[model samples]
Target: MASSSYFEDSSNELTCAICLQLFEEPVTLCCGHSFCSSCLENYWESREESTACLCPNCREVFPQKPKLQKNVILARLVEQMKLREGEGSHSVGGQAEGKDGEGDVTVNRMVNVGGHESHCEVCNEEAAMRCVPYETVCCERHMKPPKHKGHNLVEPEMKVEDPGCTEHGNSIHFYCKDDESLVSLLCKAEHQDHEVVPVEVAVAEFKGILAAKYPPLVESIKQVGSQIQQVHQEVRDTQVSGREKEERLEGERREMYRAVDEKVNHMKRWLSERQSVKLSHLEHQRANLQQEMDSLCEEESTLKASLKELEAVSFLEGYKDLLCRLESRSHFSTTEPAPPRLLDFPVEEQNVDSLIQINDNLLKEIQNGRTPSLDPNSAHRRIKISRDLRMATRTETDNPYPDHPDRFDRYPQVLSSESFSSGRHYWEVDVRSRGRWLIGICLNSMGRKGRGKECMLGGNPESWCLQKCENKYYTVHNNRGTLLSVPGDPERFGFLLDCEEGELTCLEDSRVLHVFRGNFMDPVKPAIGVYGDDGDSVRFCHLFMISFIPFCS
Candidate 1:
């Protein structure tokens, strides 16, 4: 049976024999002493390994046959103590009193055996178990000691084997949230200016914040993408709509153009029809008027022939009566009948007197007609008739009608020699003074009286009038008294007369002359002045005036 000492020594059982404390890597020495493995190994190596077993408590030497054993019973008891102590319960160390026949003797023997057997608190029986030797074994009553002598052993809030600060040899307890700085409790005292929090609390706060904001950020990005898609769709719709409208407007414009083209063609057709009708009407009127003119000409010729015949018959009747009277007088006288004396002489004398009388009457009639027709006052009547005829015929022909009807059949007095000769010619003249002067040359019917009266200036019927025969000439007198003339028509003999000075001189048709006013003979420059029956008055003068002087002069 175990002695009561065994139960009483349970309080000190946790302490190793060599270390004098709870076992850390516990082992049994060869001398049956329980100690920490490191401490027993150190003590054994310190000896010389002599054949001896030394007792650490008693200092007794024994035989050299020492053995080492793992303290399995002690290790099992330590594991049970740690389990009970982890639940925040205190462990007891005293053994239970013997119940049945077994007393303290059994307990003491069990403790001394030092093998793989543990005493159960309830059963009081030896139990087979296996244990690791390094664990500390404590008596159930003394597991969580109330007052540790040297160490303040408290329940570990965190595991002791986890990594910690090597420099401080302490647990890392504080975290720097800004820099994720892992700091020990000791470092917090030095780095007090930094914001430090417990590591567990900071981790929890950061996770909560991230969880709260994540949903809204994702939703905002999705909404922005949706709006962009909507804008793209709207732009496509507007472009399609604009294209449709453009096509519609183009169709309408084409229709409008077609309508306008049809209207223009219609107007052109109407205009062409109207022009054709007007042309036909004009042709009909022209044909009718030409027929009427032809009939009038024929009637006038017939009337003249009838009047000549009537006059001849009257003359014959009168001559017959006179002849009978002469016969009767001769018969009554009886004495003159003897000689019929040269009857042919009286008849001839009578015939000559009658012809003279008829000539005188005809001349008187012609003179009366000439006075009125040649006078300038009758110009208005002639001009009216010419203007009417020209206005009627201008659209139908290229030839211009006469302006004055009375001038149509008359010849011009002042005529160009080129017109009379109907050929090309030229003349030149020189001026005598150093100032502006008017020089003109006129061709008439060998006299000055009819110089402009019968002249036809322009060939067109309406323009051939006496008033149109007027020509103005200007010359600068440079005191070079040589007057040069060139003939416009060379075949006809002609003369130049200075009307104001009343001087006339003959010129060979082909000759050119230059002289002062008084020096007709032996001219300084030879020239010829030509005249003709056509109506131009200054034909020769105009052709030659510029050859003798500068245009400005």
Candidate 2:
């Protein structure tokens, strides 16, 4: 406590956690928390658990009684505190004893209340009040001395008196307003040319300055708070919109599955009904055959009964009847039952042309879309960009453009200033002048630097590309390459990106070469990469419609 302010500033660090007072003999535990040695010993003894002594602060257990070692640094600070406390009390008590009785009371009252080393220096008793002018503390009975009579006094809690100047060792009664510093009698001589004011007047002036700025500062805080609230509302709306879209898509998908399931159930019912009808027809045919056999058997029985009636006359008479019946029956014709008809299985052929036309329609819808602009900041140093920033060309050397962090340092690459977060977009690049080049849509996360950078288009998972090399062309994604067997090398190629469907299609000379279905990881921009110099450049055609010259307005 070189000053009471010093102890006040570091009070938390000096105080023991258990005793709640300044440390007497500071010691450190193995777990790194320091506490008073006697307090720590009592804390452990209260538990009586020696196998694991949990730290009071961190609650971390140590295997055994950590040899409590004296914290040399903290011990020194405690000793210093003791010395400084005595010095502070001596200095303040001496100053107060030389002053009025009321001042003496103030000093002693504060000394006891603030944990100073001693009480009032004159009477060695508790102080009740302060002497404002003489800056001292004294008991009420001691305020009636000849030197203390008629002196102004206030409670010690007010602490209105200022500590004397350290340089001149004189009581501070004035404030130099120009320098904004406190000064005693001898120190005021140096500030004679400066504007000096009473200490109370200077405090009032400073208070007015602070008071003037409060309203504006509060208003600024309110303005910032309002803007933050607006941003929060907007972000909430976006989150709600995205969630709604996902829910709607799920509902629609379930509905489609339900429709397909219902169709399959209907077909099963129809098949069951058709099978029953065929079975019923076979049953009727079987019954008709049985009835014909029964009739034949009945006729034979009647003829046999007539044969048993053996009278010659009767036999002769029946003979003609039998013969006539036989002749008539022999001339009669009988029809056989027709076989049951076969039921045909209902099978429908898929339309190959219609199935193949899905990508065609998607291409048409995606082609008429978002406009793109070349980002100069993304262009490589060796690549020269047009004045309007719509075109990029390879130059002999680096251009005089200012460097940017987003610029491509390793590859001859550039990205469009505009990016697509949602919806469909299409662009065709004209690389007729260059022999080798690459064109693709890349994620904004595509790396700007490093070997095999994702921004190298076809080289990494962050992007996909349809690259051309000499007379051949290939599709690449996630560092894997696929060669395309094209009819011819098409310098003019088109790229269609469907963000919602997560599809990327490449069109070469009015024919689609490939379709990549990997979903994008983030908002994406159209990217261009080429290897050409001086006499060669890659041009972007202005088009917004499928199978048509791109028209940019």
Number of the top lDDT candidate: 2
lDDT by residue (tens digit), candidate 1, 452-515: 4323322221111111111212121221122334334232222333323333333342232322
Model 2 misplaced regions, further than 4 Å: 1-368, 548-553
Going through the candidates in the order shown, the clash numbers are 40, 15
Worst 10 residues of 2 by lDDT: 544-553
Top candidate, metric TM-score:
2
lDDT of 2: 0.68
Please, what is the TM-score per model?
0.23, 0.35
lDDT of 2 by residue, 256-335 (tens): 45645665666578778877878787788778768867866776787898889878888787777777766766665546
lDDT of each: 0.39, 0.68
Error of 1 at 435 (Å): 99
lDDT of 1 at 345: 36
